[model samples]
Target: MSARRQRWEIRPPAPADVRERLGLPPLLATLLYQRGLLDPAAASAFLAADYATGLHDPFHMRGMAEAAARIAAAIDRGELMAVYGDFDVDGVTAVALLTQAIGAMGGRIRPYIPHRAREGYGLNNVAIGQLAADGVRLLITVDCGISNYAEVVEANRLGIDVIVTDHHHPPAELPPALAVVNPKQPDCAYPFKGLVGVGIAFKLIQALARYGKRPANLRGRDMLDLVALGTVADMGPLLDENRVLVRAGLIALNETARPGVRALMAAAGLAPGLIDSGAIAFALAPRLNAAGRLADARRAYELLLAGDRETADGLAAELNATNRERQALTRQLQARAEELVAQSGRAEQPLIVLASPEFNAGVIGLVAARIAETYHRPVVVIEQGGETSRGSARSIPGFSIIDIFDQCADLFVRYGGHAAAAGFTIATAQIPALEQRLLTLSRQYLRDDQLAPRLMIDAVLPLTELSWELYAGIQQLEPFGQGNPQPILMAPNVTAIDPQPTSDGAHLRMRVRAGNSVFEAIGFHFGRLAEALQRYPTIDLAYQLAVDEWNGQRRMRLLVRDFRRAGGARNGG
Candidate 1:
């Protein structure tokens, strides 16, 4: 965690007229207004979260017709089809969802997830050749393939038609596949252009179901569990259509009778019915991604599609062990990267770029992400390969890290990613040049203020004002992620009582009181605050209000984000 004291950015209060105009509670209206929901009708629609009203017709997406027709033709002909996905959770869930959906329609479809260390990202000709040899007449890529032009051509040469269904940014020239179904394509006008890979794959399933009555009655809603898992795990925006999908998906996830989901929840220490997007992002996603990072992603894909409880439990335990291994390795690599940064005297630079043989290519992205979060700057961490090196980049909120590659497009062998994260391959000899070029670019593009991280508080609400009713209203903003965030409420002059490190010695647990209202607060990773709280008993708090459910009892709790001595300086990380 970053030790730097985050500069607080509190939103200005909402207009008083917003309450009467929207006909909602004061706090709910304020939260909605703060999120730019001013119109009465729009606010109602947003709060309703009605799936039918919110989700667009799948055919509304540009390539839906073509993609759906091609897949339908394959199924009608009884051709062997495969869903080729990336190694991450987003790709794994996508492969599972599409495979199951097609199989339910009497199509023999299997999943193929690339190994992060071996076959690498996107499509490889060798894997495509292997799939072709397995009698696969059709290949549909989920979460990837927008950038695999040559691989798609190779599939075509092997007499297999390819359909590219991805959400990543498309190239100037798309693959000559049978169909392309990415929402980010230049000509695509998907109202919500932010569907992650599985979200796009879900839309393809919806489109295929619309082809006929039998497909329509395939119980597609049962698959929302996969959609929610993938979307939140991949950091997709939680607004517009995505909000509706995820809200319903959470219901599906909670009520899922699938042995795989049940076992995974148990493995993650989550109550079956109490899971949320946060649990998915923090606990479930990492464990699922661990298989890809440390071993074969097929383990996770198989886990999601497992039929029996024993099979599911075995895979879930494997993923749990792999996650533990991944965590230990991440801690080790993070220390080394930080040590390298301290030694390089490059901590003050706008962009931190480092390359070493010790940095494993599979986990460099995690290291870069942690570095970027700690320093609030763009970061590039590369693994020194024999001749060509692979690098992963993480950016601050407003900056597009991929732009660093776009500006230096001529130097890389291959590159693709989103605004905040990207990956590239370049000649090892060109690393110094890449660093200097990145330095030159970051100076022109980044400002000093942007380098200092800001903690954004949604609104200021004293503890006395929080209530069970208000918490229920907040539920309307379900499945919060990238675009929509959980409300962070600020309460000033909070008195800290009995503040101390938790039993595990990894967090801070304390009782907080504001006026007559009191709440139990827990600060994960803020265990060091015990000393500061002992000195300054009175402090201000930035926190998210949550319900702690235990033994069938529930009570309001404060999940502390940060705190500082009242009228004094904030605690440094």
Candidate 2:
């Protein structure tokens, strides 16, 4: 094990109106105020996520009018239409949403999701030819087709009109599609710029509703489930319109989800009526993503759109198995990646770029995220194949992987994504050159302080303020992510009254006291820190206050995130 000592820093939140309005205890109020819900009305609205108030008019996006017009024309003339999507959860959800929406609009529609291992991502010429051969006159691409200039050109040549509805960053030259509906486009004026691929498709559906061309009886909230699934899975920020969509979508997901989602939740041992972002992130998303990661993405697409319970259950089981397989593969690949990083003798390099022919391309992004987290640096993992190498990248906050790739555009055959996550392809021979170029770019852009990992704390609190009433008051800041994160509070000199090792030493069950209040706390995935339990009877802990319910009992529990030896005047020692 490495002997690197973990550092601790505490920054207290500025006081606000949390105590007065919600009758909250002081510590909980400070944490809530720091998270930006300083006003009572705003706090109420944030928790409620008023579905009616949050949703935007679908026609607000730039190309909605044109895209909807074309689709409406296709419906009027009864032209064959195809919904093209990517293979991941976001892509699968987009395909499901659009195909369902279009079918409801009395339009003849078929769904097409590219094979992850074979055809790769985005709209390809081969798929275009196949669609054309099948008598498809109009093709609307979801989750992809923004940067497929050559493929779009080929699609037009094959007499297929393409409408690109994507969220990926656009290149210098746009694809020659009928209309591009990406909010990331330089000149576009979409109010909410943080839409994922499914969000874009949702906008198109909204536009159809405005034109009175939508399915007359289709419920809008029914589609929110898909929007929530894709948005969270793609790691889109849970703020602005995304926050609105996901908040409502989670409610819909829990109450009236599709057969596939219902079956998936059952397999994952999650209650459908009580789903949250955590459930989607940890359970549903991975299962849907597994099909694309290890096998054909079509399996996921089929599962989501299955008509019968038996079919949906079977597919969900298969996807669950695939997810298990994917998890094992990722572990193996991560070990190999760590070995490569060790051998390179350049661990401190600003950007990590590693390539191996044996690495699975599907899980490279996840591998990149793991490597980035471990090293506190940006990472790009590449899988070198016969003629070309595919790569996936994840970045730290201050670093932009897409911008870095844009600087070395000459080396890539294709590249696209947001600032944080990106994907690309290049000739196998250009890997070294591309790596060197990205490192040089990183050295120029990254500051020394930016490279160090820092945890942002919402506030510092005394132990006396942790109460059931205060915990309930904090619920006003619900559905947190991106701009709004779950608040972390630090309390010093908290004595662990009862500390017991749990579950093969992976966790700790403890009761801690601060002033007059005593709370049950669990330190998850902190078995390695067991030695510190005996060394420090009273310590400082950073944690989230939550209500843990078990067998009809409800009590406040501290979900311990980080801990350190207490210091300064407050330390009883």
Most accurate candidate by lDDT: 1
Candidate No. with top TM-score: 1
Q: TM-score each candidate.
A: 0.96, 0.92
Q: Write the per-residue lDDT of candidate 1 for residues 1-573, one digit (tens) a residue.
A: 222378777776668777789888877788889889998999888877888778988887877899899888888888999999999989999999888888888777888888888878999999888998999999999989988888898999999999999888777789998889887888777888989999998888888878861343447778999899999998999888888888889989999978888899999999778889999999999999999999999999889989899999999999999999999898888899999999998899999998999998878999999999888899999998889899999999889887667888777877889888999889999999999999999999999989988887777788888889889988777767888899888787889999899887779999999889999999988887788788878887889988888788999999998876675333322
Name the 10 consecutive residues with the lowest summed lDDT in model 2: 1-10
Whole-model Cα lDDT of every candidate shown, in order:
0.87, 0.83
lDDT by residue (tens digit), candidate 2, 119-163: 888888888899999999999999999889999899899899999
In the predicted model 2, the residue pairs found to clash are none
Cα lDDT over the full model 2 = 0.83
Q: What RMSD does model 1 have? A: 2.3
The residue-level lDDT of candidate 1 at 407 comes to 89
List where candidate 2 sits over 4 angstroms from the true fold.
Answer: 1-12, 15-48, 496-511, 515-520, 568-573
